[model samples]
Target: MIGSMPILLPVLEPDAKEGDGKEDDSGDDGQRLANRCFVIGPDGGIIARYDKIHLFDVSLGAGESYRESRTYQGGAQAVLADIGPAKLGLSICYDLRFPYLYRALAQAGADILSIPAAFTETTGRAHWHVLLRARAIETGCFVMAPAQSGHHADGRDTFGHSLLVDPWGEVLVDAGRDRGVSLFTIDLDAVAAARARIPALGHDRPLTI
Candidate 1:
């Protein structure tokens, strides 16, 4: 559900291709493509959709840089949906780095966080596991991430280690660098137990910056 989807360009704006790396102010400063994720119910209906709020715009050395904002528009709002057994929070790839969004979702009653991503080989090798585990530990919510692996059509490589982490920061499943389906069982009761033991989510206080 996390992938490329195109949107109509604003009438007064000029068309800019995906890899242009040019700044765009049209479409209210949004991109022509959206990095969107969806929540689907078991009955084959769409429950909710979340456009990624954080775009991947970084330099990875070797004269390599990505400007996702040039092609994909970032979402302005966080989304939470009811998926029968649990309340789910929807987020696309780059949004994983933003811990505040996940915390807000957890505070808003999300039992599971879905972060589907296409992380590059470089960053994924370094920060993938730690970040995912950190988010689960911080929020006490089960995390289910599905990532793209191997070479891509754009001459870029992705680090694919699809993961499922429990609320207690236990890795239930780790689908290594391959293309296949991974299945794991998650116990929803663990969420409440973890939170009851830590209780960090309830300890937040207003701070002055």
Candidate 2:
């Protein structure tokens, strides 16, 4: 059984009326809160939570569309947490596309990155592997992605190729189109070794906007 539910990171949007004392209804904000992942310690207690800053919104095919920003709020802060043996960076699905977020996490000393997703079959088939490997290579961190696969009772199908990538951009394990567990050992030392060889993280200079 799961230990607990997600911790919410609330976002605030400007109200329509701007300044009439009741511009935005505070009551409804909770419904549009951030998608967060709790960093659970090995002892089964909650240590920290990272609210998903990027929401998934796209049109896949005929009669398939999603608008997460309409239903869920976007998070503004990036968080890093320690989970016993590893320093992990927390993020959800769509956040994977944003490099800045992962860089920030790596800069904060994350050895591993966890991304939990229910990725649509269409996009996942095309981009999942490439993106996950890129992030791992760029940040020199191991990536742990647990995903949803197969068609659900609601007739919605997800492409599940859950991946475990090492710091050297190697696909250590892949749970391809199956609903099961994939086990592998993560050597955190690899993170340090890879970073030491490439050292790209330290050499990046802020680009002038």
Off by over 4 Å in 1: 1-31
- CA shift at 107, candidate 1, in angstroms? 0.2
User: Each model's TM-score, in the order given?
Assistant: 0.86, 0.82
RMSD per candidate (Å) reads 6.4, 5.5
* lDDT of predicted model 1: 0.81
* Model 1 C-alpha lDDT per residue in residues 1-209, reported as the tens digit of each score: 22221111111233323444655655454436766665655555677877778989899999778987666656688999887678888787889999999999999999998888889999999999999999999999999888889998888999999999999898999999978987556789999999999999999999999
lDDT of 2: 0.79
Predicted candidate 2 versus true structure: per-residue lDDT over 104-130, tens digit per residue: 999999999888888888888999999
- Model 2, poorest ten-residue lDDT window? 1-10
At residue 156, candidate 1 shows an lDDT of: 90
